[model samples]
Target: MTATSPTPSVVSSVSTLVRSPAPAGLVGHRRAGRSPAPLTTGRARRARRVLAARRRPADRDFRPDIEGLRALAVVAVVVYHAGLALPGGYVGVDVFLVISGFLITRQLLKSVGRGGLRALPTFYGHRVRRLLPAAVVVVLATTVAFRFVGPPLKVRDVATDALFTAFSGLNYRLAWVGTDYQHMGAAASPLQHFWSLAVEEQFYVVWPLVIAVVAVATRRRHLRLVLALLVVGVVAASGWASATLTPANAPWAYFSLHTRAWELGVGALLALAAPRLVALPRRLAGLAAWLGLAAIAVAAVRFTDATPFPGVAAWLPVGGAALVVASGCGPRVGAERLLGEPLVQCLGRVSYSWYLWHWPLLVVAPYALGHALGVGERLAVVWVSLVLAIASFTWVEQPVRLLHWPTWGWIGTGATLGGVVTACSALVMVLGPVTTGTGAAAVLASVDAPGAAAVTVAPAVAGTGPAASAATSAAEQAVARTVAAAVGTVQVPSNLTPLPQDAADSLPPTSRNGCHAGFTAVSQGDCRYGDLTAARTLVLFGDSHAEQWLPALDQLGKAQHWQVVSWTKAACPAARLTVDNPSLGRSYTECDTWRDATVARIGALHPALVVVSQSENVASSSVVPQAFSAATVATVRALRSAGAPRVAYVQDIPTPGTDLPGCVATHLDDVRPCTYDRSAAYRYPDRHAALAPALATASVPVLDPAPWLCTATRCPAVVGNVLVYRNESHLTVPFSRWLAPVLAPVLTTTGA
Candidate 1:
């Protein structure tokens, strides 16, 4: 998060006090700005006091080092978001929070000291001028730019995020959506980075009032002590909450102000003790500064995406920032000298605007270019954002901040900007939904557009002999007719089963009913699906890939007089390998627990058949296919040992990485672009190859579903007037139900 408040104005306010030349006696005694020789006599001691007075804490003057620190923090964040090697660069937000706490607290405490909260209005006015102008510009620019470059399906999300940013509530919105599994896969919002700005702004609203209350309660005496106690209380409570919640609910812990306020409180504690910290010896101060930098560097280099964050991990960067600010209270150090470099200062100057502009450009560029950006293109985006930030800082930020305006003028400025965002967001929402003009349903119906029939019909229809009909079954013959009629089908049917916009909601009964578990769920709760009273039981087991077949299984089970039980969870693969869930930022212990419980539950059910399916993408980069296959074979053996009469492993469908609904909507006229090559979907290191040998040894049959969903070389996004894959991989409910007839024979046969 960019620290919205800059130090230049604060530094300028105290410049006259610190910038004046030394007295005549000091000029002779002090050589080249170094302090005079150590005082021994009473007269020398008095001169020493004067020198100390001249060397006031850097906090009381323009500390270019603070500006340089801002540069470091923003650069880290940018690099991390740009997919660089610095995994822990996210700690930059912690540094900014601490800095905000220290700087804002200093200003507030000074106000209380002067006139007992008389400066509250002025403090807020300054904040408005400093923060809102540049933010409004970026929000407006992002909304407009995305409107032009982004897909229509994503327009509404970006607009909503922009509106929240304008209202200073983006963090709350992000927190809610971050934990929502349904929306988790949506394209990144351009204004998503504004969540940090929202955090700072929210803190600003509450902290000044706290200072005012403390001053009144203490009768303006012992105010610092009371304030310190209050800050400590906040730190303890928020820190405890962060530590407890991060592993269990990372999104709320990461984005909520309640969990984040402690970092700022740490900075506030430093501000309270600033007056006394100036007495530290120069050597000790220099050491502290270097140690602080070292701590920050260690965190940035050592931590990774899998590290649980914003709890104990945050203390490193937060404490380091405090030390840096505390060091500024004494003398200049090596850290300070490096921080004050011209290039660092320049970066610091426009860091706020750069933070605002960089994320939006990175998100929109791929859509605009119609492809993912290469490393060179990403670097180009970084440069372009820097240029825009410089321009925003020079023109909009300086002009609005320097203007001499009344309180009402500031209020009006905020309202106008907010209004513009609202209007723009409304415009985006109104224009977001796109329709591929209606096509002829008659053409599709006449051809009997083959949905699953594509796989079976092609081979049988190609054969001219009457023996082909004799060779194929009755159900296969029906599929053959649909496939033959739909051979050259290219136009998308007007009567599409699930409209593109609503396609993602095509979940199975188990998913809708509480049978399908969520990420944190450990047990498969009452997941029985069909023919509840049937004598024979069938179990559908694994992750979402298994759940995707539920519509078919449910219908088939009822017709075949078999009970259907669904055991599934989001992102929790049936494979035995332990996963590192990026969302939780840790090893997926919950998944292991769920898998164990599911195995026990299935053992108790003593199902006549257990059909297992898991996503091909389940094995992450760290887990090799051999490990996955071994784990899977073990699971199959365990199932047989637990009384499952038969076990079948269904091969996963080819994953079309593109969002099918959005692609269908965007390329409605030319459906060919929406189809995926079979080779790409079944690319290298195939899960089937790994599992085949082990499964064969275990005598478990492997069922390939490709023959039902695809042709020899490609898989169409839409088939037989029904949308196929809903999002990236899951099949739509309508399509899954259509497969019930084809899937029935395999489930019924003794060999299956």
Candidate 2:
């Protein structure tokens, strides 16, 4: 719908279009239509003036009950989000949406009757006053809390999110993150409230224009017809889109203007049709209201985080809200009385502030404490949110909206907000990296190590000759001589060189670095060196999922005397075929370019062996295993054709769980209880099945490590006192070291 054009002539003609008042007599109760006895003639005229001051030609008496309904909606939202035993409470947002549409449409229609259906600036001014004050206060407070208390990763992520909150795009962001908000845990964002605000703000931007266009186009001739068409169109479009998209596409469906339009349209329809609908008998109206409340309550109790949302499921709350709006006060029924009770009405009055304050409190509280909230902590957060909401409503929101602040005052407010954001951004920019802590740094460092540990094996007893022993002695002597020369002319001790500082630092506290070529410092003679200084270099590559095997590789390196160089990037799998590079601002580039270069360099050095893996978990689009197999076949053929020998491909480990860290953390106390659903973990079994053919065609020996890692029933957590994995699909250092004995036999095999 197009916006209402703001022409000077239209503004001047506003007063000429006022409508006549509604019929003076109440059709039902005799007491309803009668005015309260006038105190005096002067007082009566003042009352009339007050009525006239409402500024709408067809303006009816104020309905404070609607405000009471708003309070109910906000309370439901707050309570459900607080993890109270109310599931359907989130539907309150739908209630508010309908309410907003009704109120906004009513105001616009009243203005149209008095003036000439065009006052875009005045409408915007009222909205700015109504919303901005409370929004700004909440956003500022959330930003401050985030800067000091949030986790390093979250702090960095939410800086952008806070900006989205300020601009009203939070709904989009939340949707993009996926709907399993509860599972996100510490990773859950702070500016989640922006989703509802986004719906409202988006509505405000478009609804006024639609109203103006319809009012002008038909001049109220076919307004109902036009409104009906709009509602049907929006509902259809939203339903179609929601059904077609995956859960990952929730943001586009939930946050986009098209999908959310029907909700506001329902509200708009209510405003235009309320007079007729409200004429029903009070008993029936009351029944409808109670039924509506029941629907909303039921939804709250039954809905869980996994529920497919804002699709057909959204109808429960929307329908409930529509019923309440149509019902008004019922005859002989206590529903209206229950809703209009002082407590409910008061909550409705301050509901806006409550909505603004609750989420930030919930998000920041647990983060500040460095833990997720237990039941008690979540309740405390809820209480604190209520207190803050009430205070903001009373002290900041109400005052700013009521006061006649000058243009300069608004400018000053904007500047203050801008300054606050800029300062927070600067603080985050300066401190974010420093606060990411030593953990990530250590992880990256360990990831950069050259190879696993190297061990010297004795010659075979019977058939093997002294030639093998002689060759081994020569290699050991060469390593010792190189160390002696590098450190000065002193005699080098066996296993004397230190592991790379990065690798050592990167390993977890429980890990023991074995004697490898790079490590030299010894405290208690526990091997601390990574064997990166081997005669041959073997590069390990793939996504973070694949890179998790560093510990195992380190163990293998010590046994085989092979350098395990890692060229891994998060979310990137090793493949010879081209795929999109999201970070590179390019598309369809080879995923294995870095690995290829490393292979060329290693080939030039002519290492005795080359080992490759990452055949599984590659992007389907890249046909990763096939590409990797082709590359390996070419490399092996090139090497074999050159008379070089010994190249092998290791099959990838099975993914343990969908969100390994969260699952493990959640079930940390459970023993003999860890479980994984293999179906959920693997989206493409066919792709995994396809890898075997490629590996066979390449004629490379495939090392299936799954049997070593998984058992008959499950992939157990511990293997010989070492945690099998540090995360979802990666091996812990201790576990990798444990695999050293098993891997040694495989590495020494001669043929492909």
Cα RMSDs, all models: 6.6, 15.9
Candidate 1 structure lDDT: 0.76
lDDT tens digits, residues 169-282, model 1?
999998887866556577778899999889998998888888887788788899889889888999999999999889887888999999998998998999898877866666
Error of 1 at 402 (Å): 2.7
Q: Write model 2 residue lDDT over 618-675, tens digit each, in one string.
A: 4544465455456545655655454445565566766764334333322333423435
Q: Candidate 2's error at 712, in angstroms? A: 22
TM-score of each: 0.84, 0.57
Q: Which residue runs of candidate 1 sit more than 4 Å off their true CA positions?
A: 1-62, 83-88, 112-122, 172-187, 240-252, 298-308, 374-376, 442-473, 476-489, 512-514, 531-537, 557-563, 621-627, 683-685, 690-702, 750-752
Residue 217 of model 1, lDDT score: 75
Worst 10 residues of 1 by lDDT: 459-468
Model 2 lowest lDDT segment of ten: 436-445
